[model samples]
Target chain A: MNDYRITTYEPRHRGAVVEFQQMLWQGGAAGNSAYLDWKFGANPYLDDRYVTLAWQESELVGMLGVFGSCWEVDGHGRVMLPCLADTVVAPAHRGGPLFGRMLEWLVERLRADEVPWLLDFGDQPAGPAMLMSGWTAVGPWPVAVAEREVLGSGEGEWSAREAVRGSRSGATITPVATSLPEMPALAAETRSRGSVRVVRDEEYFRWRSRNPLARYFHLVAEEQGTVGYLIAHRTAVDTDDGPTPTTIVECEALDDDVWRDLVEAAVATLPGKVVTMWVRDLAPAREQSLASLGLSPTRPSGRLSQDIHLPKLVMRSTGVVDDAGPLATLTSPDVWDMRGVSGRGWR
Target chain B: MSGSHDVQDVARTVLDCLRNKLFLDGVTADTHLIESGLIDSVGFIRMFVVLEEEFGIEVTARDLSLERFQNVGSISRFVIEKLAEGGGSDKPAEAVRA
Candidate 1:
């Protein structure tokens, strides 16, 4: 530990970063270099120092990624906010001061650079540390689920050889293409409904859809453009009955018909699966829209809450912005009208 | 190193971190660190990190169960077993381990 040092991430450290995440998370996308490149390298919004690395001599012991985003904070208009994600520290160094040291280093740098704020959807096991470091949990937003039975089995199981190409409810739901000319303008138009959220411009949509680890489906209403998208991923969690599938949906600025069509199309694509996503309380209409399509409000709070003390959206201020002015309600979770937010879309 | 000495070194590393980083006090080998408020899940993560760096071991998700990390004695025993299995050591290896 005496040889330990912290520095900004470099391309040479890519392999080490992947290796550290593999050890910390017990291997998954963390071990994939292509995923790392897609996440950090290919991203159009990140700076060179988006990642901070901790090294014990030549070994990469820790990593914390500060994923940058353009956040619309009510009165402040749009401010650049960094979302803390994919934090990992070697287990041997967990009980030491290394983690704290790395956090302080990152916070101070962000402050010095005048970054407005830091936000995170915290890891449950790491909740105590986050709160202890002056982070505020914004509480788990209400989650809605469309169960398999209610969604109704539309077609047989999707075969592996078959491409994810289909349609339902007068819309085309297909695997997202590498590039969509309308994605940039459509994403900006979709998120311009005047609410607090991560700005999803054309570049964001393209980069997010390119995630090597997860697959996303786009629902395009004939004349409505890109109305919605869904990312359905499996979770290790199990209920009294058995294993259940989890899906995240985002369709904030869509018309009623488009939204319903997208939901039906998504459900038809992945039949008999439980689709789940966080819904903002301010947007009762969105919840109502999903409910009308057979989705129900489930008690994901008790089973999925990060911790009793830790809220779902844990935030920390860098004192670089004035929260009292136009952004007075910036820290208040109640003020965010999360109409188009989805589980995968937020990151 | 002797087993007791190794355990003492591990305990000292963990306690020193608790006192310095978290401002904790009066913790002992048998203290219920997690249950007694001396350490939370985050603190437990820190402790594991220090132990790994100090002894050169790779603690995995399977090693996170409460039984293996209840107290100083339990933690030391777990580390000693992991070290004995040659999971990690202070000695230099041919390949780098993150």
Candidate 2:
């Protein structure tokens, strides 16, 4: 612990950046410079404010990403906390102190800016680490996703095969059964929306555009060369099929059947089964492009972070302390008594 | 009969306006608007302001949550329901208002 000092890549340490990312990802599949390019490219939207690296003398021991800003949220309201992610500690340095040290440093940085909250997806093992560092888990967004592509034919082995194919690198992306009668209209509508498209280098595009843990496919519609639409590869349907390969539709500004085209494109690319996307509550139209598909009234689930003492935001469910059990007895006769750690999605 | 539907409408309108004005996406019934990664605590207060601006609804700190407005369906339901109930409660609309 005494041996390490934290640093950032603001000045652009190409070699160090590559090294840090290599260490952070830690696998041949770590997806190097191409990955960094994507992460940086996404900075405009992701806000990519904090990417602090921990160095023990000359060795990069860990890194943390802190993205904080204000954004309008659909269902909840205006959100202004920093999103914390990409926390990776070198396996050799995984003792109790490093995580806390990184967070303390982060808290200092955020506090300096007067930012209120911090949010993240936690690895269960890191629970105690955050608690020791002063992060109380208020709750988690209720939804999560996974990625896969189907191929070969209508809803059959081919579809499943395609899902596998779509996930692998260099695999051809084919649209699976997106040829719906409504596709033309869907594509037109997606095109009409005119959302700024997300552009990334291929590897970075695939990795940055996906759910970090899930690695699902993220497709967006592009106009000319600028991107304008996006499609998440996770689809939620009436049934909970096992290990389902889903593409969720996160954003799109096109007018044409954006849903139909992306879905169709997926169906075609996969070369099998019905390619589908998971959307929260009820919706989509496509044909233009997946990523360019319009946003539904539905909000994708994820947690928000905030300074505990904000004027209006108060903790009623009791996650402030490190208690795993529900602090208060719930009186909801209708809902089940859900109790767990503070970050439990049901809290 | 009227309570649930009214809350749902206001919730939908709020969600729609946020997406339109603020560039938010992936909203749904079970989506925890407040807790979701979308907003921070301060952002939460601004949401109330937006609601007021867009729907003419006055929300307070106490009027927040599932017990009152659980989902978008319930949120809209709660807003309209509570509004219909005539805003006479002493409790604040915490979820919607700061």
Candidate 3:
């Protein structure tokens, strides 16, 4: 094992951290630096920046970050917990115990602070390792995709244009200039099912809209007040076919018909070739709405097969709380309201 | 119901996958795959796919433990146990030998 020094992130280490994330961010240091600041600096949940770094002498070799997130557990109170994100190791230092060591150090620190639980919205590539490290895998949450080609219209451009203008449901879908002030009310009114969900207040909406990594579009359905709303963001993803423009619906109205109309309006106006969102099983109405919009879920061969590349909610107890009361609720997939909880939809 | 021959076949298939898919050579049944960082997350998933296809076994969330995949020996033992539990095909191990 190499003798690598592990330490917490300090402001002086900002420049190196930004440079280290360039490969991961792909938008150069400037964009990554801004993103880092917005995520950790302006965050309302936690005060200190919780980033762990591994250094081989003076060179930064690996990094793991934890950002504060607020979750509202039904019947239970709200708690601010850390969500693991931005895990990266330099290419030259790949295949080593550096990542494990860094993770160990971070977990230890969180444990010392008496954090009850830790959450991770990691990709499939990191899934097995997280599972091995005692993190409970929640849902592999199937994602629904809407593609222009799948509509089977020879006049692809015309169909999408028509989708934007065709609102037969009598709901007026208008693109909002900024994050809706009534987002919290709208969310509260729509959410009837009891589960743990991110507290999507005005503060969260404001912070989420300020993501420097992607461009966001907010559309609201106003009958009297804000009846329903949809938040979608577009970002470039390097697929096998090269960098393709991908739009992800981060959050939407829970009402089926409203959701369908919001999605239809957004898809027609969004510039991306593909638009996707996480689909939970219990919401048959939401599923029907997506189907109505010509979106279909990508079928993996098996749940545990290698074809399973979707992100899952992984969690672990910090061991600070002896009671397994909260952990039981968290581990159950059915108890999670996972919309916009993924923190930056493209994770 | 699995015998020594079945275990050997499973081990061989695992070794072949380690070499072919992960580009990991010189691995023994007792060699450390996870702790030594010989196989990464991507490599682990690739090996997973191969084991599922070769053995016609379903690896579930409960099976995703470090102890089950720590090394070739452990993996072979797990596959054999799963096969005995009717988790995989009843076909002879020779048919799926990598």
Candidate 4:
């Protein structure tokens, strides 16, 4: 029975999609519903129409969700594009052309819609398959980590929130409930250094803070004004050692000293926890700052082994761009400001 | 580390892993593990772990190409080459178990 049909997602398929996601998420139906809603249902750029589904008759056998995002190319102001995520296929349909077929359909749809290209932060299990499906491999990006031994369970004596609230080293760190009003201005003030990055506008920050799967914390640094800000989130990941408490230091200030202070305060909050942040193409000053803070680069073996597989960004053209277009810029690993680029459902 | 003996041993181990660890029956040395749907992405990782543990060879980034892992024969050859290059280590196998 190799008769698999491909179709775009509709409202009627919501229940099936949620149910199908349990195989991938294992977060139960309610959790899956909330994640789906946050990622696509309430997205500012794209709608549910971009979600593609595969079926064997009426059974929902596979799905590939394409969500919208905006990028700021150096010369270009803002370019909206789709990113592939939340891919799942039924066990009964394993090891077949179903994945390739769904991808082919999605690419065709993106081409029809005139999208220039699509991106995926492909994990270890998904990396090779994506490469085989024609996605260009741009990275096995490096990540930096700082870990400390906790005397006891819980936050111990120091509180992450309290640490930031207390001032140190010229700048004051203040924890905010959401993105600071000065975030856009602060982001604008920081130079991109000729890289394509996610547009960190007010709308993007507000939307990013609503991710239900992650508990986000925002900290703003002020010396004279809003010099910098940091966003970190805590999530539990199932590692080889069981559920590990992990804090992703998602984004921070561009200034080395301010960035160091922000990170120090953030790490102080979650004492003894494993803290990680992207370090690919990091500036020398920032790299030194992280090292001074006791964080070291954790390089992946690229074998997709037991150790954490290096996160690779994969892309494929939709045939909408010429040779001299933005595709060349996007393909270069050095051209991405990777902070906070970790996709939805990163756990 | 005799070449022919090593190849045979690697092939046997690869086939055993596919059938036992990955639960894929009838996987032969020449079977197209990838194209035949016997090994998907997750399966590929699991298989890599078995190879690393069984051979005590550190699988590096350079060894990650799809062509190198397409089938039992290819995987066996890759393992033999790695073993020949003194890739074996004294590190405990438990350290790399996933």
Candidate 5:
């Protein structure tokens, strides 16, 4: 029964990959051919060589997808980093050695190709897997949830959006369908702050935030010039409580006042839906701003901890370990920051 | 390393890290790390890193299920399988070696 084989992804395996993913997701992600193509195919950072598949004879049993990212690593300037995306092992194979085998193969490839670092916002049980696979766990990444009502039920009489707009602050919040033209410059300015962050340039915004299949919303608030923008997605998840719609705030760059206005707009538009975002829990100023929006800090005991319903930020280095200067800085939680709506981004 | 040898090695490494950092005096193979409140969220992550580096095993997220990781014996079995067969397929580690 040694029918195990692994290889790089080929176009011929598209349908099979979709079927495999659909089975793994249990139809929640609509892992059809089109979605897979757009996700893996349209990736600006996609290296055809990096998309990997594991097969048991004729069956596509497992997959590890890697998306290319431009990241600002401390002391290294801007570098190309690969983010490990969707990883799925079929139901029958869930608790076996297959996951580690696939990952070992993936890591071997990364080491051979000289990929610098691997970045991912993995939801369990993959998050814990990453830590076990020699990836550094960096958290408690803040998941700020703004619940209008307890248990996220009951609608409020006053709309956060209307109140925000009606205020005497004079800032205006407008929702747009695409990334704003000014976003490229603003994103560049954001990276100039010296925090380890994703390079959210114009290309990244257009590709990541403007996917055709997903209903990602871009809301911009401005008073004098472009104050800031918020990238949001709406989706639901099955929790211990129940199924609840959530407004996922993907990424944002705003001053305190404008941040307030944009969050207000999201709360208004979604009304009762809970709003969530990833913030640097260690940073006092960032935590204070999110606290103002009513998001509490949720940390899981381990990647597999039951509370993993909350999000976590985990990373690992694929770079030369001996050249410890830059990698050491990257490994430090103090220098690194995760600010976005991550983890299986509503497709 | 033989299976039993590897198991003892893993148990030693795990217990040493736990005892020094969290100050737990006695931890046996059957000790429930999570249940006894010995390894909290922070300690669990620290332990994961140490084991992966020491044993050269890849521990995936799904493998963190309580069934496989709740005790020293389970964690040792996991490391053995990974080391023996590279942790990809469910085929018995002995079969691959044979």
Candidate 6:
């Protein structure tokens, strides 16, 4: 008999989500409150694509959510991960193979869907699972800050045509800071992998994009009110590198050439030499867009971490297939889904 | 021939910097930088920049470990002393990765 079983939630059971949260965080009100806000608050952006819970002989062993999101680069944007904001293992079930199993289960789900995401589960539980799977790793995209302001403060942002304005004459790009309302409809049009769930909509949009720690920006190109390519700025973070204005290109349809031009246009508004913006990998278009602008990605050896306390709360063992239909197969979308990833914020 | 910042003082400073800046909403100096919700791998590059800029030192991509930047306090202490030594980054590739 299977002593341990895992269940991946459809949509998200906020009640179940909260209960699991309370159980995992035994540190009382302060710790629990902080944990909840961090996972599901304006201050923190939680992805709802893959949320799961584990059980060991009727005990709620662990639960976690694999939050999928879209990121911006110079080119196209697609779904990726930002938070692995899941709590694993009840304190009583501390030392067992539950942790590895939970992680394996998550990986199998991700692999099945063929979706790529950044693990944000406090760096502890994720270390082992990533190692076991040997996934190709990327960044601690340096979080830097410019003399910044709160996001959505109605600031006068750099215009998209600021690209052409800063560059050669007759540049055809325009940067638009979209109203919070547009995210959902645009997100609904997004393409994604398998049966993965997304938490896109207006309310989440306003909350996720408007947080103090989060920074978002977008680029759009139009020839005659007919738009072509667009990109998103992920969350803004403060670091000793000063501060960085970051963007995750959530989705893009422009061919590589147009994407490259757009990147050149975008980089003009940045703090020169300081490297305030850290655009993550998105469309293949960004492959050269960043390079053309004299910008380069920092290279580093893989960073690793391991869970000390909540091992069982991490992830599950793989090969246990989901009972769903074709939607269950985990293959990434050919086109990036924007709202599903905070909508057009990144692309 | 020690400089203005002592080995321990360097540690303290690094800890202080992390707490003052990168600490997420619920994070503090005592919180483990890696194990906490403060950062991810891509975020580490920025961590490096912060260490260099604020501490007036250099942390090469080669000088990385979960131990070095494990906690706010540990990262500070390590960087301060490393700075006193000219901030030279000549650690062997093996040691940095390990």
Best by lDDT: 4
Which ten residues in a row are the worst by lDDT in model 5 chain A?
A: A152-161
**iRMSD per prediction, in order:** 14.0, 14.1, 7.9, 5.1, 16.2, 11.2
Error in Å for residue A27 of model 3: 3.1
Taking all chains together, each candidate's TM-score versus the true structure is 0.64, 0.40, 0.87, 0.80, 0.69, 0.41
DockQ, structure candidate 6: 0.03
DockQ of each: 0.06, 0.02, 0.33, 0.27, 0.07, 0.03
Candidate 4 lDDT over A169-288, as tens digits, reads 568887666677787767767666556877778888777777766656677888777777877665422331333444554545647778778878766654335766776655677776
TM-score of chain B of 6: 0.67
Off by over 4 Å in 3: A149-168, A236-245, A299-302, B1-5, B89-98
Model 4 error, position A61 (Å): 2.7
Residues A72-153 of candidate 6: C-alpha lDDT, one tens digit per residue: 3222233344446545667665445556567667777776765444344243533433433433222333221233233332
Q: Which should have the higher DockQ, number 2 or number 6?
A: 6
Q: Which candidate tops TM-score?
A: 3
What candidate 3 keeps of the native contacts, as a fraction, is: 0.42
Model 6, residue A11: what's the lDDT? 35
Candidates' lDDT values, in order? 0.59, 0.41, 0.70, 0.71, 0.60, 0.46
lDDT value for model 4: 0.71
Docking class of 3: acceptable
Q: Per-residue error at A346 for model 3, in Å?
A: 8.0
Off by over 4 Å in 4: A22-31, A122-124, A147-168, A235-246, A270-272, A291-296, A302-308, A344-347, B2-24, B49-68, B72-98
Winner by TM-score between candidate 6 and candidate 4: 4
Model 3: per-residue lDDT, tens digit, A190-239?
55455787788888878777777766667777666666777766543233
Question: Clashes per prediction?
Answer: 17, 125, 0, 1, 8, 65
Please write out the lDDT profile of model 6 over residues B1-98, one tens digit for every residue. Answer: 23576656666565555656655456566787655536654355556656666665666423555677777667766776677678744433221211
Model 6 alpha-carbon miss at residue B57, Å = 30
